[model samples]
Target: MSQFKIRGGKPLKGDIVPQGAKNEALQVICATLLTPEPVTISNLPDIVDVRKLIDLLAALGVKITPHSPNEYTFQADTIDIDYLYTDDFRRRGAALRGSVMIVGPLLARFGKGYIPKPGGDKIGRRRLDTHFDGFIKLGARLRGNPGENFYGVETHSPLQGTYMLLEEASVTGTANILMAAVLARGTTTIYHAACEPYIQQLCRMLNSMGARITGIGSNLLTIEGVTSLHGTTHRCLPDMIEVGSFIGLAAITGSDITIRNAGVPYLGQIPSVFRKLGITLHIIGDDIHIPPHDHYEIDTFMDGSIMTISDAPWPGFTPDLLSIVLVTATQARGSVLIHQKMFESRLFFVDKLIDMGAQIILCDPHRATVIGLDRRQPLRPATMSSPDIRAGVSLLIAALSADGTSIIQNIEQIDRGYQNIEHRLRLLGADIERIP
Candidate 1:
């Protein structure tokens, strides 16, 4: 496995630019199969997951042309559906989580779709029931058993629209069913749908392509089925997860960094949540400026109890950044409780940080209590392994602020979500390099 060798205890300064949103790109790229015309997409992030999805599209005979490094035009005029049954297709499709999205557009236009059981990060139990359940509700017949290696969804006739109350607000599940519903015979109503900004952007793009969708930023979504859709252009927003990671990096490393074109308006509660950690940041136009600090503090609740930071749906702090927050709080002036409600095992990475001298108590699988060191004793670096994307970057942040050189293994997890991370960090005066 590739590892990162980082010399710690040095501040990083300069401007950094986050790439386009990875989640949104996965959704919209699959939407291209809804029409035969060319769909031009710009601001696409070049990461492992995104590349895997694009490769899947190409394998299905979607003609892809690159206009620039971050822009592409896709035309799915002719698709080789038979390829889905091949070994190559099954092996490639199961490599990334986003592969399931292709089923929606295929079933919408071609009346069938097939995929192997998909794979992704091993954070915890991630169920695909939400996805297939929505498809079955839309009058499509499922073609395989629950635990089978390969499954399929097909409809003999055009799908009929109906109302569905999602069990949970799953982003990919909603995107999948929404794509299928747009071509149904009548109106479809979805309650408790995911309303994240990326989902909202997908709705806007669909609307521009002639789909009748209402409730752009709310949980309730209404879609009037259209017979067909046309081509359109879409530019993805900057990744908020990356922005939050950078903010955490600045907080722990005592650095002054300016993040350009951060799309601050869509970053709901992220800035305020960091502010609660006593990290000073200024919003100038669309850029975020975090100044160098000697030390930071954690704010308590209004009743003066220990502040509890948790994750909820949109308009609430994202669970993706909780790892960043937990790592940032290592050297803060006070204590806080981090509740990771959605995923059980995300907080497990704290054991590695504790080895580096952060005072953290794992209350359970879902909660961690952090007592900040207040910079009284700097962390002593040691070798560690990255478990996932967020946790990997969080460890990188800790290593940068620690007193000695540190080694991180299995960084392919980091590259799955981040692009040229070591190169980018080096540009900001960070002492980080990749080693074989």
Candidate 2:
């Protein structure tokens, strides 16, 4: 295991080009199994999760060739579908939550698919019931052993598209059902579908591969099943979550940083949400430039009351950035409520912030009220451990901008998302080192 030892209180300044979206890359890679032709993907973030997914794909007999660095061509012409029953498949597949998505394509192409319970962050209870419900709605029968934590699906007939409303806006669940719906016999009308950028990218990629899909950015999606899908080249979009992380990093550390190649259109409600926190972004071409500033003030509600920033479905502030926003709010002047409505346990990380001397009220498992210090007293650094991906990065941000040296363990969680995070921060003048 490795840990990061950071010396805080230095302003990070430089240019950072965001990596390709990890969520989009995961879905796109799985889409390769829909066809036997070569599907090439470029600008993929070289993160641990992506690499693990690649390993899982290779195990399934997908021929993944590296055309160049950060680019690969995936061919599933000789897939070993039986590998899904192996112990290796179950262990590795359960490592990341996104691994559950492989079931859709595998079941669609082959007649059977098997998967263990998927694992990722422990932020809240992520139910796979909706995914199973979607599969059942499409004519697949599922049987699982509760003691073994293993699941299996088998279907002899082709999946029949039907009208179904998702219980909640589950991102991976939407992608799984979307993939399955593409090869079904009829039109699949999905209401309450997750229309996040990753899901939209998956839909667009499927359309590019000859699957007819409409309602790209809406809660309701219509997908027309095609006989077969052909492979094509698709580039993954820039990770807006990472872009938001950089924005928070710049503001809290009082740095001037430029994030290049950021997909501005995909950053729905992000810029405006941060602007309410008094963080300014200068748009120059495709780059978002954040200038240096010592103090930031929180914007109040229209009634001249304390403001609140919360997460919702697409076109709303992203839940992924709530942790970053909480850390940024600690350095701003005034008070704001950070409401994370999606996940119940996400607010538990505020205890670490309180340990650093920031004023925070942990109202419940889903909400937190932050009163910014306005740089009055430097946050006292302490030893900490990363709990999850987003919370891990938020802790790193707090540590980097704190008063003294801090050590953060369990950095593998951070590696699963961010690409070369320590090196990137080092380039931006942050005193961070990785110790093994």
Candidate 3:
């Protein structure tokens, strides 16, 4: 395994262009299975997760031809459905949560699909019930052994659209059902759907491939099932979560960094959320610029009370950035409540920060109150292990700004999403090294 040895107390300064959204790219690649023609995708992030998904697709006989480093054309015309049932694909498919999306398209096209338990961050109980529920609504019957970590789905006939009020606004669930609904016999109305920018991009890509979808940016989505779909070229959106991560890194490390190609339209509540934690950002055209500051103070309410930052469904503050915000708040001058309402275990990482001289009150599994020291007391660096993708980046930021050298293990978790993170940090003047 490789580790990152970072010497802190350095201000990072440079320009960084964020990679394509890994979340969106996964779903878009799976959408290729819905058609027989070639679907070209551009601006693809050369990350571990994307490469794994592409390998899974190639194993299933999806012809993939690389036109460039970050571009590829995938043709599912010659797919061998049986390849998905093999042990190798099943084991590899479980490596990422995005792989679960293949079940919907596979079932829709081949009348059957099999998948092992999907794997991802161990944040909390990420159930696949919502995904299966969508499939059942689309005329699929699912069955699997209780103790077994596999699922099997078979459809008696072509699916007919039905209205479904999703129990939760699960992003992958929405993507799964959206793909299944595209080939259904009738119109499907999905209430309480996830309307995040990534989901909206999936809908737009599906539309370009001859699927009719309305309510692109809302919780209620109406998908008119089509008999078939063709091929199209799609450019993945710039990753907003990475943008937020970089923003937090620049602030905590006292760096002046500019993030290029950041989608300004999708960063609706992000800047304001950081602003509450005393992080100021400037949007120069399509780029977000974060300048260096010696001391940052958290903003309080008009009633002269502490402010709180939390996550909700789409258009609300993203849950993915809560860890980043919590880490950034450690250097700010006031107290703020960081509530991670979506996951139970996400707040556990704060304990590591507290050990490094941060004043954090772990209210519960879902909430924590952070009192910023305003960079007064230096944090003593220590050995740390990455827990998840977002938390891993947060810890890296903390390590980069700490007083001494620190080692972070399990960097593969960070590589799953962020592309060339060390290289990007180097460009920003961070003294981070990758050690094998």
Candidate 4:
């Protein structure tokens, strides 16, 4: 495992451009498999997960050409359908949760899809029932063996689209179903579908590729099945999670930094959530500039009650940024509740912060109470292991603002989502080194 050695008490400066959206990249890359035409994708982050997915595509005989850094063109003209049943595919696919998305496109175009149980961050139970159920409703046969840890979906007859009201607004499930429905036989209506910016982007891209989709940016979607789809150029939105993380990093380190090309419109409720913690963000065109501050105080409610920040569906605070929010709250003047409604085990990383002298109470698996130090007393650095991707970055932010050198182990988790993070932080004048 890799480790980061960070010397604290340094304020970062200058401009940092957020990378491409990790979640969106996964969906769109899988969408490329829906068509045989060459698809060009720009502004992709060169992170571990994205690279792993690309390698998976290559392993399936998809021809990929590198145009430049952050740009690639993929042609899935001739795929090795047999590769889906191989041990190599199962081993690699199980390591990434995003790999499950491949099943949608493959089942749509090839009439069969197989996946070993997918793996991801150990935060909570993410069920695949929504995905398989959608396929079954669309006339596919499902077979799985829990003992063998394998799941398969196949259709001998052509799929006929039907109305599906999902039990939950699952992001990946929505993407998977949308991909499958685009090539199905008839019109499909999906109610309570996830309408996140990533999903909206996928809808737009699919439409550009000849799929008929309506009601974008809203939960209800109607798709008219198309005979075939062609290639299209897609540039992913700038990563909102990374943009929010940079905001937390600047607030924690008292740095003056500008996040360029931040895609401010897609960052719903995030800037306002951070504002509750007394961090000021100035939006200049498409950039967010954070000025240096001596201290930031958490805002109380209008009724003089303690503030609470919680995650919800789209246009709400994202669960992915709750860790950054929790870390940033450690230096504020007042107290607040950080409620993670989506994932259960994500809040356990607060113990590592408590060891560093932050006042945090882990109320349960899903909620935490934080009492701010108000920057009067700097945090004492401590060695810690990163529990997950978001927690890893939060710990790095904590280490950067601490009073002594800290070593963060298990940084492979961080690399899974972020691209050249240590190098980017170094460019911002942060005192961090990636030690092998």
Candidate-wise lDDT, in order: 0.93, 0.91, 0.90, 0.94
Model 3 residue runs over 4 Å out of place are none
Extract clashing residue pairs from model 2.
Answer: none
- Give the alpha carbon lDDT tens digit for every residue of 1-436 in model 1: 8999999898999999999998899999999999999999999998999989999999999999989868999999989989888999989999998999999999999999988888887778777778888888899998987667788899999988999999999999899999999999898999999999999999999999999999889999999999999999999999999999999999899999999999999999999999999999999999999999899999998899999999998878899999999999999999999999999989999999999999999999999999999999999998999998899999999999999999999999999899889999999999999998
Clashing pairs for predicted structure model 3, backbone only: none
Clashes of 4: 0
- Tens digit per residue, CA lDDT, model 4, 208-309: 999999999999999999989999999999999999999999999999999999999999999999999999999999999999978999999999999999
| Top of the candidates by lDDT | 4
Error of 3 at 91 (Å): 0.8
Candidate 3, lDDT over the whole model = 0.90
Q: How high is the lDDT of residue 410 in model 3?
A: 95
Worst 10 residues of 3 by lDDT: 81-90
Per residue, candidate 3 scores C-alpha lDDT tens digits across 231-259 of 99999999889989988888888888999
Runs of candidate 1 with Cα error greater than 4 angstroms are none
Error of 2 at 396 (Å): 0.8
Instruction: At residue 294, give the lDDT of candidate 4.
Output: 85
Pairs of residues at least 3 apart in sequence or in different chains that clash in candidate 4: none
lDDT of 3 at 195: 96
What C-alpha lDDT, on a 0 to 100 scale, does residue 142 get in candidate 2? Answer: 95
